[model samples]
Target: MSRRDPYIIRRLNFRKVVVVTLISLLLVILILFAFITESDIPFNLQNRIRVHREHPSLILVDLMPAFVFILLYPMHRIMNRAIGEYEDRVKESQMIVDRNTKFARELSEGEDPEPYPEMIESELGKALRMIQLNIKSGRRKEKEQTWIAEGKDIISKILREYHDPGELSYQILQALNGYIQATQGAFYVFDEVEGRLTNTATYAYNRRKYVTQEFRIGQGLVGQCAYEMDFIHRTEIPDDYVTITSGILGDRKPGSILLVPLITNEALQGVLEFAFINPRIPKLTIQYLLELGEIIARTLLNLKLNLRTRELQEESRQLTEVLRRNEQQLQENAREMQSAQQKLESANIQLENKIVEANHAQSRLHLLLEYASEVISIYDESFRLTWISPSVINILGYTVEEMMGGKDMERIGRNDVVRIRKMLEQLKESPGRIEQLEYSFIRKNGERIFLRTYCRNMLEDSSIGGFVLNTTDITESKQVEKEQRLKSRMQSLSENSLDLIMRLSASGMIHYVNPVVEDYTGIAPGSILNRSCGDVAFQKEFAELMGRILSEMNRRPVKKNLQATLPMLMGEYRAERILSVDAIPEFLDGELETILVVGHDITEAKRIEKEIKVQNRKVQDSITYAERIQSSILPEPAHIRKAFPKSFIYY
Candidate 1:
């Protein structure tokens, strides 16, 4: 019945059996001895034996067996107890090994392992411990890889969308804080010129209070991290280290803080600091932070380098333009000198040659102004035009002769004339300094043109002792801006409308959708654009109706209005929505180009209508039932006749 039964025979008690056997043997021997001592012996053998028994050696031999048995039995009992305890320990050790093996198997299969309570001090325990360590290490490594991958995706998205350093820093800090479960964090970028770190962005920071925004290289934990180009993780945070606040719980000190330096190419770019309420942060989290720091640092450096490159390129372009203008001016000066030298050689023809050279110079300047869309004119101190470039004919619809001798003011609006007078006075007071003014001027064709004019006093030159004005037309740009403003107003109105508005091309492809569509269909407008209307309609009948409408649109006249009631899918549940849609066709150049559809959600209205109909039907049924009850209560005409067989008695 029991496992030990196989080894045991008849369930014998060894101690009892040994005692009984020894007693029996001793009794038999004693009986034999008595016989030898008391009975008659053959041939005098018993008499000889009795004589030797009186000696000391024979007496000692008789007592030895009893002493040996007494000592050996007690020793056997003690040894048996020790062996039982050792056997129990061995069984316990074997169980521990089996449990550990099961746990290891579960872990390998990516399942949670059962808890093992037995502690084994054998080789199996040490091996199991090593396996557990390896499993933990592997899990940590997987978590780190996943975290780093997600962090990289976030960082890349930030870099792609934001170019401003402040915006990038803020997004990066917010993302990092969320990933690391930090209650508070800040990003500090190194300012090379100031030799200090400046706080560029912060997460969960109070803006109304004064926060430390600047740090020296070795000032605090943040600064030290940057200086050392390493990270610091502290769990034994002091009470005064950092405070975290919750709206429900109020303020408390953070349990841990981490400071990491964003370093790339052996150079410190910035420092990132985070405070957490958890006292024990996983080492994988720290690894993620370090990897993120390197990526952020490299990305920031690239952004800065790109910005610097753009600035340099812009400066170079400006310098090149300046050089080009200077060279053109030098060429003009050279031509003028050549003309003067020729005039000096022929003084008799000097005045004629001078007039020709002056005309040539003016023509060349006019050609340049025309190519640049500029109008140049010289004005006297009395606001009289002395000279004007012929390009004014193209810019302001005014010929050079019409613009000369202050006649250009006739085309200038009255308000502009007044503004020009004030600008002239200012120009006289600040000679050789340029002033810019933008105003509207009447063109020769009675059209108002917007022009930006640069005015500078040329008082130092004796030949032209007044001001030079260069004007550029800007009417087209002004018109475009006005149109843009009107478009923006229309867009705002469409976006806020309650009814769903959409535009579809002649081919029935969705072209545009307003924001209200998302509210009705629970799908973003952007997700459905360029798709056929039939594809998105929920019901088969609605899809068929849409196909029919698109097919008839080509044959229908412009401005034809069509209406339909169709069911649409609503929300994640795909609930039926009854929509009353109105499609209005828009025509361009006598051809239908697009259809604008406006849909009103009428699902609730339809439900109410159905309920009203059901109530009416119930009311009719009640009336019929009441009539049947009245018929049963009252007698029929034939029954009344039978019952009133004695109708004559009534008469």
Candidate 2:
């Protein structure tokens, strides 16, 4: 564009020169004609000119106009050239503006515009390219992070909602397959006892081929992934590699195969297989899968643990049921033997058997209590302890003897005692109802602790005449509650805040956006979530500024404060707002989590500031005007003294 500028400028200069010289010549011609045709001229002017030829002064007078014309021509040319140069500069500046405008438009439209070869070295062009690079890189980062976050959410939901690894593995593979845009997928879990990887699920599987498939470590691609516990990507597919099958398209060869091992803490748990026909998977997606492997593996391990725990709980419940029946039988037999001691001698043998069963039940009950991590104590109506679990030593740092009859065993708060007493009275009246209480306590070792106590009224029962209290240490849970409350408060502050608050990852991925952003950006927080900042429809300058800020933050991790004007759509009107934004880095456990952005709308404040400045200037001008008027109208000291000799000047 600038290459032809010199030619255009030279042509303009030449045209100016021609116009000025032609006008000057025309004026000279007109003067000559006026003089030639003049009737008012003296008849002896020519004769006088000839007669004064000998006079040097007349000759000088005759040549004065020629000398003046010669002197002024160069000045006229110089002025014309200067004006032409100014016009040329205005043209070039306009061109630059037009070029910049075009580049901005292209960038906004998501088109990568190239600068002219000659303009590449210019600062404006370089900055434009840099901004383009920043935005594009931010977009890629956003996409990669979104994929990883979404995959994790899906896998986490599966882990929470399902306990069966069979169903869970399928769900995980299905989500990964869809997310990766793969043609086919499969999942396998490693069985430690069997020393093999067993297929748990397959994408679009046929019912006939639903039978489980197993492979020893180092046998196949899936086995290799499990054996090495690393990713396996192959662009070349073997003819015999026919794991992907379909009823409509049977035995279709894949273009590529990607196997990822699910590992947690350096331990292999499973392998994931994905097949792509065109081998167009993004490297970012592969990297995401690698990072997500740990979470998946951990979830699988948790699921297996949960299954084992449920089995153990079932067995425990069965044992408890047996213990209850045996205790009831033992009580019945003892009553029978007491009533018919003389008549029934066979009752002794039955009583012995029942006692033996009762002892076994008692021993099992004690074992259960030991593993239950709870303390069971009996308290009489007067709150006197009768019996306490032997587990109190471990749970409360106090032995059963110390807690059963010890003074100053607990120090309930003054305010909590009333509520607790009220609950106890209700239990006494109900005779069978259970009441739960939570309170802070001072242990025997003088350590402050928290307890959750559940008490049931059993005074009406012949076997048990006191209240049964089941107590558990809940100090750790209380700490969790405190942290949860703090988190809730922070979320509440963000939700109710007037300022726009958003969280962005270090790479410019939007993690969260407050609803207030919608008011200024005309974009809903929902639409902006999990998206790139560059992809948002922000005002031109603001979009570029956001990209620049992200780039700077990545380069140098520091808090950034920037001001921007954003366009907003109000009800039936459009408006622009000036916002002051604070971009602060948020870290968790020494790792960068997100960038916290708080944007405060300062448009109204800025407007009022401008108005105040204008008002102050006006007031200052009024004061200056008054001072000027006073100075002009003031009387001299001498005049005042003359008017009143007795009066003296205040100064």
Candidate 3:
């Protein structure tokens, strides 16, 4: 249908239809005039027939504008219907935005909300209301759960975050006012330091300020709430009510207050005061604030507990370090004590060994001094005898008991005792020695024996420990030595005289024959020495005489003379000889029983005795001459007769 142009179809209107209809009518009249002028049967009937048949296409075109108007007329009603529906939808969307904005704002403030408007209610309001309710319920559940699970953590945090209860009280007021969409309220915190309630948080319209004034508990509405430990809801405030924060709230001209004490299990920690921007807030709205206030209280308690726990943890760590240091010091002290004990034990062992060695040395010294032949004694610094060796009992002829009792000193000669004391005193001052001095000591048997003493001073620290005495008995030795000298002189005289001197062993062998033996027997000692005296001498009987002499050598008083007659082998003779003999047995050349004999020859005297018969008469005559000399010195017999007439003189 490219043939139809609607723009062209719409351009023709009723005025154009009128103008085109007039021009068509005028044209038909002109065509009819030409047909009638040509003379046809009846002119008037001819016009009517011509009009019905002529211009059928022009009549169809004239009806096109009317058809176009009918068609465009239905489109105008359709356009108006569409415009009205669009306007209604716009109004509904605008209402939804307004209602949702109100819902969001109310929910954020924690207000008890009303339903949305009807316009939005049929659209998105139902869903939004359900979501808001769920949000509120979830928030309440979450708060309760946190209070249970982390209550202590919350209390500790609150105590750390807000130093003063008043500061926290203001936070609660702000929270309440924000939720209610009312900008007026007050908060009272219990000031335990000041022992009163302080108005802390306040809001009036768009303004906020803190009031530091305090009131006694039960002094006003706020105080009364803390004192009673209960909440006060006052919708109509009395004229006489005490006002603590007066000019702070804007919309709360003289609004009524609700005072609630922030109570825990313990006494009141703080109090809260609220004023509605209006005379009173909704009951449900205040209840909502009350529930939130409970959360704040629980959090404050938890904050206190957690702060204490953290402090304890720090303290425990410090204590552990101190304990570790103490343990280390104790261990070091124990080690030092053990080392000291070991050193003491080692020193004790060495001391014991030294004591043993000293005792052994003392025992040996005692034994040696006891067995010595010499008498040994020790004295103390006071000159009192302390100890003497056991040999004193044998050598000094005294018992140990006697010596210990000072009896031995009493037996010493008086002069020797004095000398010993003087020597001891000198040794005490200056220590020295005294060699072999003769001292006499009386033995226990009352024999005064000569003692040869050797003494030395024993000193300790320049003072006399005592004196040591070494004594020997020499009385018998002196007697024996005197006898030996006499024997030697007699032997020398006999050897030079007309006598025979000889020494013989105990077995009768001749040991020595002096020169006199050769002169008498005409035999040299060389021929007679070691030969039996019986064989060398003239008679065997002489050997028996020599044997008898040697046997009696040790006997006392060997001075004896004998007369004998013998014949010599060199000449025939019967001559008489007088012999004076001395014999001694002596130890010679380490052999026992050697005899010394000295015999004098008086043979010439025997011859003179034979020649003179009056030898006995001469001995008698000499006795008469000795008597006559003795009478010369006597008084006369007459004198004796005159002196004693009654007595006869006996001559």
Candidate 4:
């Protein structure tokens, strides 16, 4: 219903009032003329005849007002209808202006603008459309300005938090995703050292399910964007292109994908990828994305340079500390040498005055050797111990007095005796060089201990020494090396397994995930750690089922094998996969601790099973149809028997 304008009604009323007033005045004039003609006043006959002849048409004029009055209602109705239509058009034009104003405000506020009204062929509608176009242009300009200001603000924030590249990338990606209403996005930074692109952060994405984290300069869409240093937008995405999953809603096929390269100063720094549910992104939005991409590129470059500067500063600090420590050590060594020189000079001065005191000095040297950790023994040419340090008691479980005259080789292992003899012979042959050998020796307690022995022959010692042996226990170090090798092997096996392996806490939070998850779910392992399984499940039912299973496993604290049909996201599609999961519960002190889950992907088998069921149903339908055809076409047994009765038919 169109609203009537008050102005149009007032104008119509004014026209009616004028027509009535004119009719009333003409009636008055006619009445006055009749009165004058019938008055008693005398008049000339000639004047009366002239006046009568001139006023001949006055009678016709007197009837004209009546005819006008008769047509007044029809004329007023026509004029009113025309005026109402004009008022309706004005109202429509006002509505268009109001709607355009709203759209313009929304644009300036950085909100989604409403679409333009449909075009109308009427003149008023055409004028409204032109007005809307002009308004939209102004709104778009305002939106661009708003976007520019927002981008600048975001870039400033990113710069403030640019100390860590991972954090910076995450913040930038989150901001971009929010601005564009993206379903998912990832940021990949170019690693100059590795010569590849590596995923640094993601928004609404499972990094553990990312199949490929490293890309060459021209590898895929992300790499291609980097190579071209431009943005790539695809609206009609293929089914298996990429998968984006949200909690409980399952996986979704993206309607559009955008890959933008972050390039600054002719250098490719990174790539940003976004998945969107909207197929047709607005032109203004695209322009904003491009401008934001430039800001991100420059920011990334700055982050790299800042990181390099920090690294260099850290290295310089470390080098300075090392040099300072080395200088201190060198000064200490020089002081020790000077003190030793002064002691030697004092000993030379006292040698002539007291030969007995010099002999006592040798005994003090032997006493100092007993305080060392390593066992020191002096042997004669026959390999008999002439003197031994008290450390021999700790290393060989033998007293110094008992080992003083005993053969040093007596406690050596039978297998190592020949090697010991060979080392001793080599020391004797090359007295200028020291000989080192590792061997095992039996202690007094009958325990075998590995020892690394350094032997040096004394050629001109008047104190009657053949060789000085320094032996260090190396048993603990050898054991540590053996354990490290075993651990390395185990870690390699776990990392290379083809099954999806995960470890979860008793509370159902993921503690670890192996690399095989990437092959199945396209998520990276590092991204899922410490996150609840419910947060990453493909469906709500799956999350609930897993929670229940985890609770039961925690209660039972036992190993279990289970089979379930789960919805798994494969690329941009959701597939019902049959998973054969093995849950191994780990316990400490009889209490449940962690659970290890290993799952095998059985989607292909499930697909084959569904196909077989479909085929079997078709076969059953065919068999039923065949039975019906036989029943319809073939004669009844009774009728056949009747027809063949004369011929003596037999069954």
Best by lDDT: 2
Can you tell me which runs of candidate 4 are displaced by over 4 Å?
1-132, 205-212, 238-252, 327-651
- Report the lDDT tens digits of candidate 2 across residue range 530-573: 78997888767667767877887777768989998877767889
List of clashing residue pairs for candidate 1: none
- Residue 137 alpha-carbon offset, candidate 1, angstroms: 3.9
Per-prediction TM-score to the true structure, in the order listed: 0.34, 0.40, 0.28, 0.32
Question: lDDT of all predictions, in order shown?
Answer: 0.71, 0.73, 0.62, 0.70
Q: Put down candidate 4 lDDT per residue, 559-593, tens digits, no spaces.
A: 88877776666689976767778888877546676
Better of 2 and 4 by TM-score: 2
Better of 3 and 4 by TM-score: 4
User: Which portions of model 2 show Cα errors greater than 4 Å?
Assistant: 1-47, 50-61, 67-75, 98-121, 205-211, 242-250, 314-651
- Residue range 494-535, candidate 1, lDDT tens digits: 577788787777887776778886666556877877687866
Model 3 stretches with alpha carbons more than 4 Å out: 1-333, 379-386, 393-398, 405-433, 438-451, 457-466, 472-497, 500-576, 580-599, 612-651
Rank list by TM-score:
2, 1, 4, 3
Alpha-carbon deviation at 226 in model 3, angstroms: 99
Top-TM-score candidate index: 2
How much is 154 displaced in model 2, in angstroms? 2.5
Worst 10 residues of 3 by lDDT: 1-10
Query: Ranking by lDDT, best first?
Result: 2, 1, 4, 3
Off by over 4 Å in 1: 1-122, 194-196, 205-258, 276-287, 331-651
